[model samples]
Target: MKTTRVAIVIPEGLSGRGGIVRVTAYLTRHIQAHIPDIETHVYRSRYSDNALLKHLTAPFALAAFAVKCATGRIDVAHLNVAPRGSTLRKRLYQAVAKALGLRTVLHLHGSGYDQYYADLPAGRQAGVRAFFARADAVVALGDHWKRFMLTDLRLAPARVVEIPNGVPAALPIARAPNATPAIAFLGEVGHRKGVDVLIDALARLKAEGLAFTATIGGNGDLETARAQAARAGVMDRIVFLGWVDEAGADKVLRAADLLVLPSRAENQPVAILEAMARGLPVVATRIGGIPQQVLDGETGLLVEPDDAAQLAQALAALILSPERRAAYGQAGLRRFEAHFSVTACAERFAELYRSL
Candidate 1:
């Protein structure tokens, strides 16, 4: 039996720390473990952060890709793309794949791609559309993104597919009922993630005399976040745990009562899915594909991005009631198992590979 070869293009592959890296690792692992007819390979697009090294290594990466195409090692090119440099790099890969007659799948993962595209010059915008138009299939994280591809990019509706990112389930942690609930914020610790807004909300909660402890895991601008938390006088209540690997994230999610991510933008956060998989509810901003994952009053609470007052109210509601947290957590777990499990996501992609 001949297996379908899929080269998954990612930045730094499994070594990187971000939603795209996590998704790539999970999906490849699942396919390797469960789907015998599909062979997945990781192809790194971006090198290190150093500008000199990135410029030096880029041509080598592209040359390796061309060699793989020339040798017939890969049947499909699965490009995981975000915005800016990612778009430029992937356009070259897509051109190479088209030249070699290999099927290509562009999996869109950009949280702020709309703004990025809008900011581009008309010629660049046309180039981006051409990149999309030439793909064999374009995978969107959710229906919202699918609409963007169809309405905004003017791509053929039949060429677009909606598939959410998924995570493996974590063992649920058992915690004794306490007066103070433990809250968690997982992802980057910067403005884009709205950590400052979270601090403001925490201040409000503290002012309201709400008893709670919070942990923020992930790296990005810790100095500013710490300064803001200290100024808000809520630093004592929150613990910052730099960038966490899969195990660290699992431990954080399992131990926490609920997960909160006030991101200003997102494309279906994997943190929310991971929290849901661990049977923990979420308090997140209603932006990007988040609303698709976090059903407003059901699985978790969703508030407007950067709105401290609304975020504080939502946090207070969950913190003040353990029953609500448990209800929401269980509902979220059910949703995860049904719609966003790693097994399900991998199977969907495997089917897509076979189709191509």
Candidate 2:
């Protein structure tokens, strides 16, 4: 078999702590391990932590990408795209790859891209659609994204593919209801992630005298969340662990009884997938690609976004019943193994690459 070379254009590459970085890293690792005919290369397009340096070095990066294509080094340009700056950067790459006659795949990872597109001017919106319509294939994280690509972008159904984010399998924690159930909130701690809503819900649970201890892991507006927790009078119940790396995330997942991510906007979060892989039930908002992963009452619970009352009710249900938590966790693990495992995701990507 002729080995296929894939240029994975990503943000900040594997060193960044963002979800897209983590997802791309997982796919690369799984592809290297399971598929021998695919050669993966990482190209960092965004220096997220440093803006001025990123702008200064943009041309050099583009030159490097063009050189790779000109030299026949990349068989497929697998571009991981998001909203805002990612869209701008990827448009250049798309044009370069198409001009060079390289097969291109746009892997959409944007959490708020729909809103971003809506906010764009009419001409720019047409340009964005043109970008997708020209791609050899577009990978959507879920059915919601698929609909956007088909109806909003008006791409042919054959050009769009649905592939969920995946995580390595983790040993399911042997969980028993403790004197106080330990809740875990993983992801950025800010309004977009609904940390404020979570704090409010925790306060509600506290007022009702439900016993639970919670931890918020990941880096984002910590002071704002702290203020919310303090004002809610639930400061004593929640612990903020600033920014958690991979090892720290594993520790948080292992100890958590249920994972909560009530984001007002999202497109399939890797944190939820990681929790499900570890046999932890999820309690997340019913938006974006969350419904696909969290099966409401079966695998876990799904509450309305920004609705602290509904979030509180769902959290209370799981915190009080160990049997229900265990059942949900087990079901989640089964779902993860069946659809969202690293191996499964890698196989799907390999198939996509081969087809293209």
Candidate 3:
């Protein structure tokens, strides 16, 4: 069998910190591992931090990507699309691929895409429609996004593929006995992420005379989250580690007893998978592809978004019961190995590429 030559275009850098970046990096690594016969190349475009420049240069970047795809010895081109203000670039890239007669895949990476499409201007909406119509396939990270593309966006069901994000192997660490119950929140510290909600839950746990320390990793509006913790009188107990790379973040996950994500909205979160792979139980909000990854009451606990009391109850239960925590953690690790491992994800993609 001839090897498939694949070109991956990631305008955003490939540092593996954010969700999209992590997915692209992991997918590329997996492809290289499972399909060693497949030739893979990555093209990263430098995006300016300025919003205006980022918007204006999108078409040019796509055109450049098109030129590279047309000239290079590539069989398939995969573009990672995000709904966060990059719709124009995604459309342009898709159009260029269609014009050049190259098979293309648009791998979407965000949640709430129906709302995002409705908010687009009429002209931009038309462009987006044309782009999706012309692409060979549109890959959604989970069922929620696959449904959004089929029912809401009205894309053909045959063109959309549901591929859940997977977790990379965790670094080796000496397992710590269930001694101190440390809770952790990993992600942006913004309002949408519900950092304030987590702080409130911690306060409620304290009010009920529960003792636990929560460590927060990743950065976003830190001072505000700090103020919320201070107001709740749990400031001293909450440790803010700020932004960390993949390796450093994994270390934090390994040390925690439970991982908490109170996000108001989310796509498949890489942090949650990382936690599961590290044998830590998760307490996350019921939103987006999170439900697909975390089986409620089995591997982890799920609470409604922004519900402080429910979150507090869930956290307290795990903290007070070492046996329950260990059970959940072990279950989570098993789930990770069975379904969310990097090897399995890569094998699936290899099959998809062959089908294409």
Candidate 4:
């Protein structure tokens, strides 16, 4: 097992704080611990999420990859790629890995990937196919993304597999029930995440005589979102904890009875899994792979994207009824433990590697 070397190529991953970075870090960490057959190395290809930083680090990243693979040490190259710049940066790694005859797995993780492919020019569209064609296998986050890779990309169906994202269990916390129940929102705050709609929904709940603390965490459009909250006269009930660290976020995830994610687009967010691991019920929009992770009505309720009225109605129901919240929360915990834990995800990858 120690002799089997694998390289995991991730862009802006080594020090980045984005969801993809966390995914790569978590899986790789567990793989090394759980599987004794493979020694894995993380080839940090773009340094930062910033465009200029990505450009600056490309040449160095390429050089590093070329040197590492030239030794013919890596038996498998597991590539974590998204769309646009992420795809462009990682192409060289896949190309070099293929040329070296290493087994390549292109793991896809982007909500807008389908649109990114469709919007590409004819020449670039062909490039996308050619890029993916180099891989020995393609890993999709869920069934929807897997269908796209096989049908849209025209890749062989046998070469694609769906491996949804997973998260580790939350740290032990002796949480005292909040007198006024807490409602939390994680990830970037912007039009894409329906943060504006969430603000409006708060106003809707206010009219219905519902009161709870709304903790909005993460970056992007805070100013615009703040103005929206102000206009809705719900600023008093909202708390903006800008860019929460892992520990800080875990606290919110554990304490909040209902975790809300009103995203317009998604591909099975790890944040939702984190909430589930904490036995926290979620109220996320029914978009993309979200339905696969969050079972509406069973685990937690799901609402249409950008519909403040429905989102408000769903949140208000959970807020008012403690019994319903506990039922949903416990059901969600069962789903998480059965399917989406880090150990389960690590074993899946280990089996995939063994097959290769």
Candidate 5:
């Protein structure tokens, strides 16, 4: 049998920096690994040299993607779709792919998609519905999202597929000695990520005479978070390391006793998977796909979103009990090997693509 040719269309300028870019990169790589005969090409809204043109000619980007799809060389065209305003071009490209007889997959990322869809203007909502209606398949990152698509959006149950995000193979990191019983927060630093909540929790811990260090990595709304940390009087114990790439993040993960994510909303965050793979216990809010990944008592602890006291208590417990922390870390590592491995996730995705 002739191998299928898959063309992945992504927004311009990601450059494998964002989570979506990482996911798309890994998905394409995995498809190539498993299906050797399957050729893969990535079509970005803008190329490296003319990246600025992607923004300048926003209206023409979809037309360009459509022209690529209509060349009769693509057996399947996969587009990463988010519910942001900039996704208008993707919406248009979906229609063009349908007209061109190219099988289309709309892979959704982000936990705020529900609000995004609900807030869309009526005309835009109609356009979104028409776009999804034309898709051959819709890939959701977690069961929570899959359920929302079926129950809330009323998308056909048969059309939605749930594929959880996977972590790449673990990188070696030398463990730090007596690492200050540190609590690490990785990823963008912003209100949406609940960095404020983490700061508040640290303040409460300080007030209660609890001693622990916090290492925050990544950049976004950093000034605001820094101001909040100062106001909370916990700035002394908090260290901000701006944005660290994948390898650097792994080193940070290995150095910490626990990982914290206090996001107001999330879809199976890659940070959690990477932390677990590195044998770090997690402390995160129970929202979106997080609950699915972090079993409350098994892999790590889960606190209510934006609850500083609960978040503080969870961190305190892990800090005081080295035995419990080790147990949770072990359990998390086992879970990663069992379910979140890249090879397993890629094989499953390849099967889905072949079925099409």
Candidate 6:
């Protein structure tokens, strides 16, 4: 049997910093571990310690791409993509692979795609569509994203497939809550993530006499978030820990009771999926592919973005009821196993690869 080879294109900052890098890492790990028939190779398409260095190293990445494609054994190029420069870089790599007669898959990971596509001029939008149109398959995170590709970009529905982001098996529920309820927020602590909203919600909950402790992880606009928390008079109750690796993330997740992220923008939040995998009940906004992962009333609570009062109410409900919290946690774990486990994600990709 001929060996099935695939090139996983990702960035070099994959030392556990961004979401796309982590997803790429997980895909590589599970596919290689389970699918013995297939051979996987990683193509470091983007790498730099800084912005200026990234631009300078672009040609080298392309040269490496040329060499790998010329080797004559690669069957597919799985280009992980986002908006802006990510789209441009992946387009170049995909074009090169297609030019070399390899099957190309465009995996969309841009949460800001709607805005990004809308901001582009009509001609540029068409140009973007043409690039996607050239792909053998366009992978979407969920139905919402699939709709965006089909309706917005006018791509063929059959060409765009939905593959939800998956996490590994659930972590042991390790955090035992003390007198104060322990609430956690993972991902970037920026306005886009609704960190300001979370801060307001904390103040709102505190005023309502619902006490809790929040462990805010990840970076981005953290100083602003701290100021916001301080302004809300809840800074003392919140801890800001920036950019935790896999092991660090597990420790943080294990010690938290509720996983809350009121992001104003999102695609499927890998953080939420990881939280679910840890059997932590989530409180998040009802946006993007969140509804697909978080079954609102069943596994977690959902609120409208920028609505701090509503978010506070939701958090208070979970904080008030230990039984309800445990139930939500158990339900979330079941959902993670049923749909978002790493095995499920790997099998889906393997099937897609075989089809290509």
Ranking by TM-score: 1, 2, 6, 4, 3, 5
Find the 10 residues in a row with the least total lDDT in model 4. Answer: 169-178
RMSD of each: 1.3, 1.3, 2.2, 1.8, 2.6, 1.6
> What residue pairs are clashing in model 2?
none
What is the C-alpha local distance difference test score of each model? 0.90, 0.90, 0.80, 0.84, 0.81, 0.86
Query: Which stretches of candidate 6 lie above 4 Å from their native place?
Result: 174-177
Q: Looking at model 2, which ten-residue stretch has the lowest summed lDDT?
A: 171-180
lDDT of 4 by residue, 1-356 (tens): 34567888877555666678777778878878778886788887866567687789788987887788889877888888888877987787887777878888888887778889999999999999989887888888887888888888999988887777878876655544467879999898898788988999989988777879899988887999999889888999999988876777887787787899998988778788888888778999998788888899988999999899999999998898877877888799889888888888888887787778
**CA displacement after TM-score superposition, residue 222 of candidate 4 (Å):** 1.9
Clashes (backbone N, CA, C under 3 Å), per candidate, total 0, 0, 0, 0, 0, 0
Each model's TM-score, in the order given?
Answer: 0.97, 0.97, 0.92, 0.94, 0.91, 0.95
Q: Is candidate 4 or candidate 5 better by TM-score?
A: 4
Model 1, residue 171: C-alpha shift (Å): 2.7
- Badly placed stretches (over 4 Å) of model 5 are 13-16, 46-55, 121-124, 171-179
Backbone clash total, candidate 1: 0
Candidate 1 C-alpha error for residue 310, in Å: 0.7
Best by lDDT: 2
**Residue 135 Cα positional deviation in candidate 4, in Å, after optimal superposition:** 0.7
For residues 110-194, write the lDDT of model 5, one tens digit per residue. Answer: 6688888888888877777777767888888878999878876678988898888887768654544254688899988987799
True lDDT of residue 97, candidate 4 = 79
* TM accuracy, model 3: 0.92
Better of 2 and 3 by TM-score: 2
**TM-score (C-alpha) between model 4 and the true structure:** 0.94
Measured on C-alpha atoms, candidate 5 has an lDDT of 0.81
